[model samples]
Target: MRILTVVGARPQFVKAAAISRAVTAHDQSKGDLEDVIVHTGQHYDESMSRSFFDGLGIPEPRHNLGIGSTTHGRQTGLMMNALEDIIDLESPDVVVVHGDTNSTLAGALVATKRNLPLVHVEAGLRSFDRTMPEEVNRVLTDHVSDLLCCPSSTAVDNLEAEGIVDGVHLVGDVMYDVLLDDLATLDSMASPVDSLAVDPPYVVATIHRASTTDDPKRFDDIVHALTQVATTIAPVVWPVHPRTSDLVGGLTVPDSLHLIDPVSYHEMLLLVRGARTVVTDSGGLQKEAYWLETPCVTVRDTTEWTETIDAGWNSLTGTDPDRIFEAVDNSSAPETHPPLYGDGHSAGRIVELVRSLPH
Candidate 1:
């Protein structure tokens, strides 16, 4: 069986790593699986894109549709057009996509239009906020996917509530699968924070969502909150995103808050694993913090991964200074993190399910 896998962003690369390893093992044992990778150049920077491929040992993309940064509509349109051509050329048995980026939407649309089966990993996630582009992408992608590989029971419930019962499977999270497999390698990687001369017992903070960065006032407030948390609770190590850096130019950054360039995937895992508290707006980070048994203070009002909140591992603060400080000040991981996601075998299950489908 031949499968065309689509990924564009940093997070998708992490998700792809687990499944790629599974594909390799399947090919060696079964000798019938052939998978091709297609990279949409949504995240073009080496730190965000190429480094992840190198760090995770993901095979080089067979086709790179270089659709770099642009307006959402234009980017999606270009990806759909480019993918349509690739789909016709390769004509794989199935097209598999990950997460809720513009690339995911484009791949789903093209695959469905071409009458090819679509498999959406990380499906059935919902923030229930239509204003967020990711929420829209997730909802639409789930509706059209021929197989929905969900990470949690909560995600499966979300899909069932939407009346999407067909083709849904609780395959657990591919990210957790990678985390378990890569923890030793990540531990061996040198911590960037160690060289920065920052003290330990620090909080790791990251803010890069459009909802916060695109709005100057919101960005300012989040920065102010981090500053307070750094001074009052603990020092903060922030790996600033390029988008956030552009807006934060000329703004006063507190000494307690150490701003550093983004690190590789392994570096980030080490930093978060050792952090006293994690404050971020990134969806993946919330789960990472939870998995690492670190308390997380989310800087957003809503999160698609509500399981963390229910599990008492995550707290929402919504960019408010007082709330952010309070959440971080009282942050603590749950006594028992009842095994969420899966047991590091989700990728094998996903590949098996896709292989079972009729060509």
Candidate 2:
């Protein structure tokens, strides 16, 4: 069976690494699986693009659309057209997409129109809010998918609640697989400590979403909260997102904060692994910090990954400075390590389900 895989964002790339490895391993054993990787170029920056595949040892994509950045409608429309063309040429048995990126939504639409089976990894995740574009994408993709591979029981329940009963399988999280594999590989490499210019016990702050960092008040609140933390030696190291950096340019950042360029996935993984604590609005980073046994402070109002909170490893502080400071101040060092996501074998299960499907 031949499969067409779509990846466009940093998180998508990370998820794809596990699937690609699974496909490769299956091909070696069964001698029938073939995977064609397509890069949608949603995250076109070099540091975000090439470094992930390099660090994770994922194979190079068969096609790079080079779509770059654009308005949401335009980007998805372009990807839909591009993916339709590729589907026509490759004619794979199944088209696989990961998570809720625009690329995943576009690939699902194209596959649905073509009458090809769609497999959505990380399906059935819901924050129950329509305001987020990712939530919209997840709902649409799940509705159209032939197979909904859910990472957790909560996701399966969410899909059933939304009346999606067909093809929902609890196939663990592919992100867990990727994280375990990469951590084992990269832990021996030199730490990213010196590059980030922070001491060993510093908190790593990452803000990417427009809602948290673009809004002036919210951004200032986060900055103020980080400044209020009474750490004498360890500074808060923030690898600023390009969008957040552009919006907050010329604004006064606290002297105790060290703002650096975004690092590669491997470097970020190292930072997460070694950090005293992690503060972020990123969903992926929240799970990553949990997997790495690092305490986390989530800055968003809501998170789809509630398992992290249930495990008592992460806290939701929103963007309020007082709440943020309170959460941080009240948070003690994390000692509990729970398998909130899965047992780090989601990739193999996903591949097995794909191969077993009627084509």
Candidate 3:
């Protein structure tokens, strides 16, 4: 059996690492499971893209579309065109995609149109907002996919609500498996951010969502809130996104808030592990915080990971200063996290399932 996996963004790369390892580890009697990786240049920056592959020990992609930044339509279109060529050339038994990036949708559309089996990992996630491109990508991919590998029971419930029951399996989250395997190495590595002169017990904040950064008032409000959060919380360590840094250059920042360029994956994991609380609009960070048993105050109005909020470890503060302060002040991890996501074997389960398919 042969699997062609498409990945673009940073989160997708992290998720793919686990599954890639699983495929390499497990043996099949029918034949060797052949895995091919394609990288769409959605995240073009080295810090955001290549560094992750190097740090996580992910093999370099076989095919690189080089579809860098552009309008959503253009980027997806370019990926489809390039991926279609790869599909025709490789003609793999199954095309696998992870998460809700433009690459996921493009891979799904091309595979389904070509009549190849499409397997979607981390499927059935919904923020219920049409405005979010990710929400649209995930929803569309799930409908067309031949196999839907879900992360949690909540995700399964969401797919059932959408009337999609067949070909769906609760395979848990691949990211959790990566975290479990890499946590020891991540902790042992000295954080690159330590040289920036920020100490532990500081609030780690990352603001890079389009909803917040694109709007002037919303961005200002977030900056103001962080300033206020710092007055009470002391030091706020923010690993500013590249886009956010452009906007922040024009604004005056308080000394209490330390703004630095984005850190590597292991550096980030170290920072979040030692932080007093994490403030971010990133979906991945919210889950990572939950896994690390750290309190999180999300700056977004809605989150797809509602289980974290329900468990009382995460608070939705949006961009309001008062709410951000209140939530951060009251943040605390649950007494016991009962092992959400999986027991770090989700990747093996996914590979076994894919192997059983009559591809």
Candidate 3 per-residue lDDT, tens place, 1-359, comes to 78999998888888889888898787444358888999988776765677788888979889888999888999999999999999888879999999998999999999989998899999988889889988999999999988899999999999999999999999888999998899889857987557767776788988877778899988888888888878777588888787687898876777878888887777888888988899999999999999988899999888888889888888898888889888888777778786778788999999988887777
Per-candidate clashes, comma-separated:
0, 0, 0
Best-fitting candidate, measured by TM-score?
1
lDDT against the true structure, each candidate? 0.90, 0.85, 0.87
Candidate no. 1 TM-score: 0.97
Off by over 4 Å in 3: 27-31
Q: After superposition, how far is residue 300 of candidate 2 from its true place, in Å?
A: 0.8
Residues 1-359 of candidate 1: C-alpha lDDT, one tens digit per residue: 88999888888989888889999998998898888999998876765677788989988899999899899999999999999889888879999999999999999999999989999999999889899999999999999999999999999999999999999999899999989999889757888888878767899988888888888778888888888988787889999886677766676777888888877888898999889999999999999998999999999989999999999999888988889889988887677788898788999999999999899
TM-score of every candidate:
0.97, 0.94, 0.96
RMSD of each: 1.1, 1.9, 1.7
| Model 2: residues with Cα > 4 Å off, grouped in runs | 195-197, 230-234
Q: Candidate 3's C-alpha lDDT?
A: 0.87
Worst 10 residues of 3 by lDDT: 23-32
On residues 160-181, what C-alpha lDDT tens digit does candidate 2 reach at each position?
9989998999988898898777
| lDDT of residue 216 for candidate 2 | 84
Cα deviation of 96, candidate 1, in Å: 0.5
Model 1, which residues run further than 4 Å from truth? none
Candidate 3 displacement at residue 75 in angstroms:
1.7
Better of 2 and 3 by lDDT: 3
